[model samples]
Target: MHVLETERLIVRQLRIEDAEFILELLNEPGFIQNIGDRGVRTVADAEQYILNGPVASYQQNGFGLWMVALKESGEPIGMGGLIKRDILEDVDIGYAFLHRFWGKGYAYEAALAVLHYGRDVIGLKRIVAITAPENPGSIRVLEKIGLRFVKMINLPGYDEESRFFEVDF
Candidate 1:
């Protein structure tokens, strides 16, 4: 995918150099409890995750999670983009950030950019987002980006309950 830039972020494909940041972000308490407990402990494990997850998704599906970076320092701060889920039956926008970046509108900024790209650049007919039913912050981000509530459903690859949201192009 081509690199996309916002005022404060640069959204691009994952690289091997990003392993440390990825591992750090994924192991955060909020990420473990809310997003899932993937347990990426080493740089090698994080590299494998980028290969098996985002890079593989892009090769197979034409889109996947983007590495979100701070524009000024060119440091990776998070990831936010679309993923084709085998169980969800659609391409869904997913995002996660370091705790330090929370409450600063970074999620909203990156998400809105991805949403626009999915519709205008990729020409997808629709896009979806799913969050744990209790994750009010994510739900608010979906709503803030203009996705409407679709329904409650069991999460794919997870045993938890989730609320699905979608927006049609």
Candidate 2:
């Protein structure tokens, strides 16, 4: 189902059929370096990831990372939406796009829409985000979408610290 829409993109739930794209995306060198490897080396693994991660989140939290696609072509270019992590105090927005689709303003557009949805639709009062210290692109997008840098902190199960950003409605 469509979760949010922009002039050029559509955000929606993930399904098992998206395994091929998930497999390719999870293995992208940039994705692994910035977003951490998801161990989705095969389409089957990607399917499980969708089922156990995003799909499960949808059922449990009413939202999760949804697929971001071009409205015109319906091609899955990325994924973006609200995430409720166990370790975080509040919901956070997350997104990742195939490197080929970077520099097109899609991240900012999709993120802004998701932020609004989290606040207006989901009734969330605050949204947070985290990125690797070296991920300037993500940092730029977070700042552009109105999240301010809060601090650098390490979360459990992660080796390195992440730059945290936040916004309140």
Candidate 3:
């Protein structure tokens, strides 16, 4: 189901049928490098990811990463939304888009919408984000969305420290 929309994009919940797109996206070199490999090697694995990740998040937290698609063509371009990581104290916003779609304003647009959703709709008092320390692109988007740099954090299970950012409602 559709969760949010921007002038140029539609943000919606992930469904099993999105396996193909998810498979390709999870395997993107950039995704693996920045977000870590999800080990989704097949469409079936993507299906499981949807069911176990986003779908489960929606049920458990009332919010999760949603698919970002071109508003006009309904073509999937990326995913963005709020994530509640157990390792973090506050809910955080997360997103990943295809490499082909990089350099566009979609990440910022979708992130802005999701940040508003977390505060205004979900009544969250604060939202945080963590990005690979070397990911300047993501850091730029986070700063653009009003999340200020807090510090570098070493999240559990990660090999490197992440640049932590946050915004208070």
Candidate 4:
């Protein structure tokens, strides 16, 4: 089902059929460098990741990471949506696009829409995001979407700290 739409992008739920796209996206160089290796090597692994990650989150939390597709071509360019993490106090927003699709303002556009949906539809009071300290691009997108840098956070299982940002409604 479609979750949200912007002027140029259509955000929707991830289906098992999207495993191929998920596999490709998960292994993209940009995704691995910024989001860490998720160890998804095969289509089956990608399917499992979808079932256990986004699909399950949607069923349990009513929201999770959704697919970011282009409105013109219906091509899956990335994944962006709200994530409810046990490690964080508030729901957070997470988004990533294929390297080829970067620098096109899609990330910021979809992020801005997700913020509005999270605030107006989901009625969330707070949303947060975390990125690697060296990822200037992600930081820029986060800041552009209205999340201000709060501090560096080291979640329980993560070894390295992340530059955390947050925005309150």
TM-score of every model?
A: 0.96, 0.99, 0.98, 0.98
Please give, for residues 67-150, the per-residue lDDT of candidate 1 as tens digits: 999999988889999988878776899999999989999999999999999988888899998888789889889999999998
Could you tell me the TM-score of candidate 4? 0.98
Worst 10 residues of 2 by lDDT: 35-44
Candidate 3 overall Cα lDDT vs. reference? Answer: 0.94
Candidates ranked by lDDT: 2, 3, 4, 1
Error of 1 at 94 (Å): 0.5
- Residue-by-residue lDDT tens digits, candidate 2, 1-169: 8898999999999999999999988999989999898899888899999999999999999999999999999999999999999999999999999999999999999999999999999999999999998999999999999999999999998889999999999
State each model's C-alpha RMSD to the native: 1.2, 0.6, 0.6, 0.8
Q: On a 0 to 100 scale, what is the lDDT of residue 81 in model 4? A: 91
Against the reference, the lDDT scores of all candidates come to 0.89, 0.95, 0.94, 0.93
Q: In lDDT terms, how accurate is model 2?
A: 0.95
**Clashing residue pairs in candidate 1, if any?**
none
Number of clashes recorded per candidate: 0, 0, 0, 0
Number of the candidate with higher TM-score, 1 or 3: 3
